[model samples]
Target: MSGRSVKKGKRPQNSGNVLAVETKTTTTAQNNVKFCLNHMQSGFSVEDLSKEARAEFAMALFKRRGMTWTEIQQAPKHGLGSEKMPASSIRAAIPRVFGDVENFLVLRYSGLLPMAGVRVGDVYHIVWLEPQFGDLYDHG
Candidate 1:
């Protein structure tokens, strides 16, 4: 027999055919504006949001403010030139904008724990939750 051993039909690890799933949820455009308005009205910050909720909330705030992607990338509040804000800070600020339930679910699904300085893009999107319209969804 030859010195070389023949390989089986099994595919190699980390092959291109192996798909890795990356899921992201976002809020609606109208809801985003409302959330941002709420955040600004209530003075929310990154610290007020949950881990998964931060990215979406941040996107909403930027959208409400009419900020471009480049503007967001170079924004001063993002700590582009200063000390980064903690993830905990962002988490803490989420409720002030999106409220409690949405933020909690977002964080739970995203599998992120409380911490400092988490990247904004790794968490959520701007279309995850439906916008609340007055008492339409409210049972009370």
Candidate 2:
């Protein structure tokens, strides 16, 4: 793997298009996302999810070290699998950065809602998750 490779979503292994995004903000520990307490009341404790699923979340968020915001996947807001809110509203909570809209992106995992974030220079900060989904965050 050489610590850097873009596994395109053509194979069955990547059916969900599990993406590894990055940010300049260094995490003290690997695979630990600062969940938004405001939008969420409570969800599965990272410890509670299956080892495989937890690993998936971690791998999906491994940080696309050098990938640009445009290179990574961005959830769409109109037609087919559209989110409840418009893209602008989803990005509204996040303040301006570097005067570029291409810097921010939203990604949906196997959970109920999608996560909103921004890519500032070399940093991609996951600001929050959409607050519309039910409390429980599970694929099934």
Candidate 3:
């Protein structure tokens, strides 16, 4: 009360004890595989896939939900091989945006269903879905 009296209508000053908080930001690595149909053409629709093939595709996606790209590449018995096919050799016309794309990531979801697309990060942007097997790209 004697030292530095507070004036009327003025708030009391805060003590000079300041605390500095150090925050550490962490980023999680993406390990799970993701899929999208961003590049799929209108001509290639899901309706073209047979009921059994559609179910197989869904089941394949479910099974690979926890698998990393590396695991998919390492295991060939599963049939979900992650192979790269030359862009020029692909049967479907690649999007203009991907004109400079050198290769397309091909994934065989089933015995006859081959999904072709580009992988950006962990998401596979599906461009073509060939239910007839070699229609998208030659297996030979």
Candidate 4:
């Protein structure tokens, strides 16, 4: 058989594998971009929240639910300036922003405490607290 005849019968080998690998890489990158965008939109973070700011946040929790001072104190402390708060308390107090009370109640009943507020490693908290409640006295 002639070389031209042999070449005409066989398909190009690299084209199919190259297309498959490119498709996979493109999909992975797209997924990564989507993940980053979602994280940015969530607006949850823990950095730059001062002790006083956290206290103010806790105070807001108290006001929303009319929680007594003692109840406020009893609120779970993830530590000073920490962003973690009991999800039950948050759900009960600020269900509009968090979620339905029923869900939180179920979590509590199951002994699976959910946490809210800014997590220590979160970046959104840093931006939110500074401009809004940087001064404790500003909280109503």
Runs with alpha carbons beyond 4 Å of true place in candidate 2: 1-54, 63-66, 73-104, 130-140
Specify the poorest-scoring 10-residue window by lDDT in model 3: 19-28
**TM-score of each predicted structure versus truth:** 0.20, 0.34, 0.72, 0.19
Highest TM-score against the true fold, candidate: 3
lDDT of 3 by residue, 23-61 (tens): 244211235677786677755546678898788778877
Model 1 per-residue lDDT tens digits across residues 36-130: 12123132335445565677545444453453334334444333111233223242334333443322211111122211222233222222232
Ranking by TM-score: 3, 2, 1, 4
lDDT of each: 0.31, 0.41, 0.73, 0.28
| lDDT score at residue 59, model 3, on the 0-100 scale | 84
Judging by lDDT against the true structure, name the best candidate.
Answer: 3
Q: What lDDT score goes with residue 21 in model 4?
A: 40
Pairs of colliding residues, candidate 3: none
Ranking by lDDT: 3, 2, 1, 4
Error of 1 at 67 (Å): 4.2
- Per-residue lDDT of model 2, residues 1-140, tens digit only: 57888877775443454435444575433333333323321233344445665665455555434333444433243211223223344323344442345433445543545554543444445555444444322323
Model 3 lDDT, residue 32, Cα: 60
**Candidate 3: residue 31 Cα off by (Å):** 1.4
